[model samples]
Target: MSGIFKKIESLVEKGKEAHAKTWHNWAGNIVLEPELIFHPKSLNDLQEIVKKAKKHGKKIRCVSEGHSWSTLSVTKDYLVIVRDMHQIQVEKSEKYGWTITAEAGATIKQMDDKLRQHKPPLSFDSMTVLSSVRASGIVATGSHGAKCAGASISDQVVKLQIVTGDGELHVFSDENDPKEMSAARINLGLLGIMYKITWHVQPLFKLRMIDFQPPIKSWLYPATLKEFVEKSDSVEVFYWPFNESELDRNDDKLWVKQWLRTDDPITTSQAELGMERVCEDLETRFGDKLYQFIVKCPESTPYITNLLWKAGPVSKPQNVVIPAPDAIHYQSGIDNILCDDLEFTFKADKDFANVAEEFNHIVDSVYAYAKKGKFPMNLAAEMRILKASPSLLASGYDEDPNAIYCFIEVLAIRHTSGFEEFSAELATRWMKKYKARPHWAKAWEHVPGIKPYLREILGKRLETFESVRVKYDADKIFFDNKSLEEVFYGSPKSTFTESHL
Candidate 1:
């Protein structure tokens, strides 16, 4: 520590109390024990910690709720908790619509609750199902909602207040250096710490949930698939897996949730989304006896996939109208199911770009792995469409000029044997075939050649990210983990110091 920053030790000790302990993300994925943890209540306090970290040659990271699935926020040297910096401001303008300014520590749930109090009420465009994540974290990792127009959380951020490595406060917006702004929109927590965020919110809206069951045999009818996406504001397709013999009987089915904004004033929905409600709709769709059997023998999942898609009191509510948030988010079911997922975006060949072919390929991949004795996927493969973004490193952006992007993800329960291998194999194939970029907020460390892949696909965009990264964090104080350095900077694992020292 003595060879690092000269006055860092003293500066860190000045503004806040520090502790040493082990920390893990909300998903229990990354667990690391840092040398020191500081709780910063104000901007000045955070500045002092950053100054100290720079002076002492200590790596630093900031965590509020630690909801990230990636290891982006883990640090072995120092960690700053900015949870106490939660503050929010609201403003209205006819041109930009409603703008909400909130500190990095603010949560989506908190913002959503506050936005609902507006005259017309306001809601964010894209959001994760779980509302507990910090607002800045959402943008930092490029989290996306099921909506097509908004794309990802970064799309909603209009401005950012950042504290760089030099302990200086800088504000960024689209009007200021559009390239840097694009890079900063999805910071990856590398450029700097997000102190505050300003988001462009939409007026209060209601969404009608339509639960429709499409037979597995014809779910991907070309015309029907096009209408499914074009008619709905947001669409989520739950492709349920089934046994081979069931395909012979043509009993398999796909469950679909199509959400569209409505002016309707009614709110009566059934089959809340989560494992707790697993049987809430299933039991009614099929007889209780069969439902119980599928529950017990998960391998028999195909028998009930269609029944759940059948309109009923559960997900198939006829005319349910709920607030934007209710219709936008559903339970993640993470609490009950110890699951892991492999999510990536890609544009299929033009001739095979439709959902049916995509699903066929996905099914083919699953069966390929299954034939090789890879473990069967437990939960249904969750699929969603994403729009392209101008952000430099936006993973969902289609690299091809006219190509469209869609997110394909598969969940494997922790209890399942070979869960890790199964996911890794699938991710490997997706990246190899599609040149996919793994989601920043998910378990993506194992993706093959992800670093070189990103470097190749991103091309100059990677350079732009590095240039801005160095501009904001020249000393690399934010490079908390060796994995990030290895991937982003092509640093050798043996020595983290190549240029700084």
Candidate 2:
């Protein structure tokens, strides 16, 4: 062991300090070897980690599952893993109704299971499709579901607790400070290491998911798209691009997944969605080999994608009614298929004119690039409609009560050649055309001049976030990454020594 490793081991208890091993994100894209890594278990342990980092003049960053594609969790000095703070408490208040207070490290699946077993049963209003992620991590990164009436996951946060860089525990709630709550809701880990988060939940509900295939020309029209979104409680669209010759029909089709609130009894044995499909078996058996081939050949992507689509759930129309948790998290084992993803969220007009126009533009652009012998995207292009969020830094944030947000993303298998250039070009186009904001947790750092663009586009919100951020972390311990500094402060700067503790 090196001198640094020996010193780090001496600082923490035996099992708490991780050996100086390199850490990588789920997609294996970003890798870092911090000077020291600690898995603190309790609130006191979190505070102690912060205090020690301050004493050693080392910067600190917290991570949970490392699902983010961005460098927000990067820290060369100290990396704190909060996963051991797993605790769950569900309570009902006369004023607050149903609320669940979960520790930062608790997984969404854990919360869902506990809520399902609750006396009355409860669940989140909106959530991401993957239940394996940490609840607080998803909330901090502004993850969202397809609920047209529901906002991003952060909007469900009613109270938050964190240990700031000063080694002091602070709590923010609407009852105490709404402004701070807004900033803390989707903090991007700049403020501090969050230890506990409380969210307002709802009684469990059932939903019927109707999957169908419709011709692209008719289904994606602005007016028609608006009708489907408005009619369903949640709508998700997936398009796997293909060359005209590969399709059996003249025009390609879209797979539309619509979820509606249902009073019908729930399916007693709800199998994981898409698990029973034959395509899933093929994917599990040959996904890696196929992905490797696509990465090497690149040109074979279209044909393989088309075949996968035919064998996928969309190939046949079907309907199933399941409880809210199952419906919200429809798919499983997605993280197993590593990929590079970039998502954008922008305001949509009531008629969805902009949504229709931009989505079609993207579809056309994909084929256009392929014709030029460039395959930047080979996987599904997904879109979801959601209501506005109150979190200041959230991509879906807006003041209008009726405001709607269009969430769309382009994905390519990880390490694909020309993918970065392709995604950057398309991202730039979307930014210029619709003032689209990229999801903070996804890939956007590579986009040309992303920092300045975000600074300019998110002017007032950035200013508000900076103000609240300094109150908790005046020394900038958590603000330790280049990407965040460039976007938030316009450039990299040194940390101030004044302590709030």
Q: Of the candidates shown, which would achieve the greatest lDDT relative to the real structure?
A: 2
| lDDT at position 63, candidate 2 | 86
lDDT of 1 by residue, 60-168 (tens): 8878787666778888788877777788888986767789999988877788888988777888876787777788777888888887555678877888989999999
RMSD of 2: 5.6
TM-score of each: 0.83, 0.93
What local distance difference test score does each model get?
0.70, 0.83
Model 2: residues with Cα > 4 Å off, grouped in runs: 1-14, 243-250, 271-285, 491-501
- Model 2 gets an lDDT of 0.83
> Residue 62's C-alpha lDDT in candidate 2?
78
lDDT assessment of candidate 1: 0.70
Q: Distance (Å) between predicted and true CA of 501, model 2?
A: 46
Q: Model 2, poorest ten-residue lDDT window?
A: 492-501
